[model samples]
Target: MIEIFGIPLSAFLSQLLLGLVNGSFYAMLSLGLAVIFGMLNIINFAHGALYMMGAFLAWMGLEYLGLNYWAMLLLAPLAVGVLGILIERLMLRWLYKLDHLYGLLLTFGITLVAEGVFRSFYGVSGQRYAVPDLLTGATDLGFMVLPNYRAWVVVASITVCLAVWALIEKTTLGATLRAGTENPRLVQAFGINVPRMVTLTYAGGVALAAFAGVLAAPILQVQPLMGSNLIIVVFAVVVIGGMGSILGSILTGLGLGVIEGLTKVFYPEASNTVVFLIMDIVLLIRPAGLFGKER
Candidate 1:
């Protein structure tokens, strides 16, 4: 066996691949949260629930409607995004005028309702999702056999993250979006519909989360409680990255996921609390987060 630092090279690289897979999902979900928080100033507690909804929606499409994976990829997120717009218009809009805590509470309630409803149907067990035939199997990398799907996951997520960052940071529409975030009244004075912009920003974020769910379906089980298990850790990622910086969110999420993976390999017990531990340390050293700007 090829060895590095007295450890089999294959073992180390495999763990790295697993870490990158996890990091992909973290980056996608955290980016969505950061976008919503930065623009709407709402800490969405329902994000996890939205992720669950994505899986359920895909299952619904497959079991009854006969939609394929590619189609569901587009349809699921669109459906979820539209629901987000409705939530914004009907419920979240009313709370935006009040304290941020109110928004959090309302979204938290939404999360519970969504999760509970899914649990009633799906039960506690996870349903199996088949990997597309194209993404199946593994490749020999001389030192290790790597799953094609995992590599696909990493590539897809990085592409999505970069595309979204470009849309938000480089485009004209992005300029408008950012301006609306900082000064809605001013943006509105110039005839841009600020409220509608806010609604769309939130919808975009929700869609991003749902899309991540679709990606996760093949590797992780498609279960009602899936998001509930991981959402808290994602929130920590958001805090550690600075809420407004899209790149910060992506880097912080991937970094933490790798750290967690390594902890599991070396010290199994600490894996559970590793992210939280880092969160506390970051809070102590820089309350603004690793890439956050001081307010």
Candidate 2:
């Protein structure tokens, strides 16, 4: 058996794969945060709550309506996105002209209320979500047995990340969004509906979080607190990657996951803290973040 650094190569590969899977989740969630902050300047403390709602929506749909994972993939986001739109129009929009802290406080309160309601109904126990039949097995890669579901997760995450990046970086609509972020009044002066754009952007960002939750359902159990557990790490990823850069979020998230995984193998005690350590180092060096432009 070939060994790398005195550890079996297969063991190392498995860990790397696990890290990549985790990074996928981080990338998607952080990307959503970046988009919302970039466009609306809202801290969105309720994002984790929205993510939890997505998973519950999926679970409920499955349990009550016989909706499969594939259908929930579309339905969950749409449902969550609509809810986000409602929040934006009815609640978040009024805060745009005020201090950013107000937005954060409101969202935090929203998080508390949402989490309390769900915990009351579901308790802390996780609900099971089986892998779809189409992706239920494992494949031998000579060195590692790669689970099909995990592979699907990695591929789906990467695709979504890339698609979002392109939408925000390449398209004409994306240009308008960026311009609005820089100066909404000017964009509105040019006849663009800035308020509408802001509302849609928030909805889109929320939908992205919901989409990630749906993706995570099979791998992680559906629970009220699942999103809360991961949201802080994801926020760290956003800060490390730079809050508004799409590509930065993607790369930083994946890189941190790989680093975290490597830490588990080489220094088990530091695995959980490695990402935060890197974030601290990055902040010390570039306060604006790895990809953010200094204001």
Candidate 3:
């Protein structure tokens, strides 16, 4: 068997694939954060809770409503998105003019509340979500066997990320959103409802988080604290990529995941801290982040 860097090639490939799967989650989660921060200037600390909500919603739907994975894939996000709309209309709208710290605090409180509410009902134990029938098997990829569900995750995440990127960076509506956030008065003068647009933008970002949650439910155990477990690392990814940079978040997230996976292979002890170590180095070197422009 061929080996790379003293590790068996098959093992390396398997780890690499695992890394990419992790990267897909990172990309999706960070993309949502980037959209919210970049466009709304709000530090959404409740994102993880919302993600947890998404997964739980999916699980609940499956359990009670007889909804399948495919159905929850669309419904869960929509449900979360509507909740996001309420959050924006009821609470977040009032804080837009204040400091980013306020938004962070408010969202943090929301996160606590959300997690508490779920924990009260569900406790800390994780719930299982079975993989869909169509994606239940594994594929032989010459050397390494790839799980269909994991491959779907990577493809789905990339597709969503790219679609969002294009929507924000290329389309006319994206231009309007950018313009609205940058100069709301100017957009408002053109007969656009800036407030509504902003609300929708926030909702969209929240929906993205929910979408990621649905994707993760089958792979990871669903639980109230699951979001909290991953949110800190995800925040590190966002910081390293740049607070509000779309492309930066996507690339940094994926890169960090792969780096973490590789670290697990070579130096298992440092696997957990590798991303943060890189984050520290990045902050020292380019405080603005890799794809972020210094503001």
Best by lDDT: 3
Q: Which stretches of candidate 3 lie over 4 Å from their true place?
A: none
Could you give candidate 3's per-residue lDDT for residues 145-257 as a string of tens digits? 98999999999999999999999999999999999989999999999999999999999999999999999999999999988988998999999999988988899889998
Per-prediction TM-score to the true structure, in the order listed:
0.97, 0.97, 0.99
Clash list (residue pairs), candidate 3: none
lDDT (Cα atoms) of all candidates against the true structure? 0.90, 0.91, 0.94
Tens-digit lDDT track of model 1 for 1-295 = 7876666888878887888888888999999999999888899999999988887788778889988778888999999999999999999988776898999999999999988888898898998888888889999999899999899989998899999999998999999999998888899999999999999999999999999988888888898889999899999999999877788999998998898887777777998899999999999999999999999
Residues 174-283 of candidate 2: C-alpha lDDT, one tens digit per residue: 99999998888899999999888988999999999999899888888999888889888998999999987788899898888888888888899999899999999999
The lDDT, on a scale of 0 to 1, for candidate 1 is 0.90
List runs of model 1 lying over 4 Å from the truth.
none
- Arrange candidates by lDDT, descending: 3, 2, 1
Which consecutive 10 residues in model 1 have the weakest lDDT in total?
1-10
Model 3, C-alpha of 205: deviation from truth (Å): 0.3
Q: Which residue pairs in model 2 clash with each other?
A: none
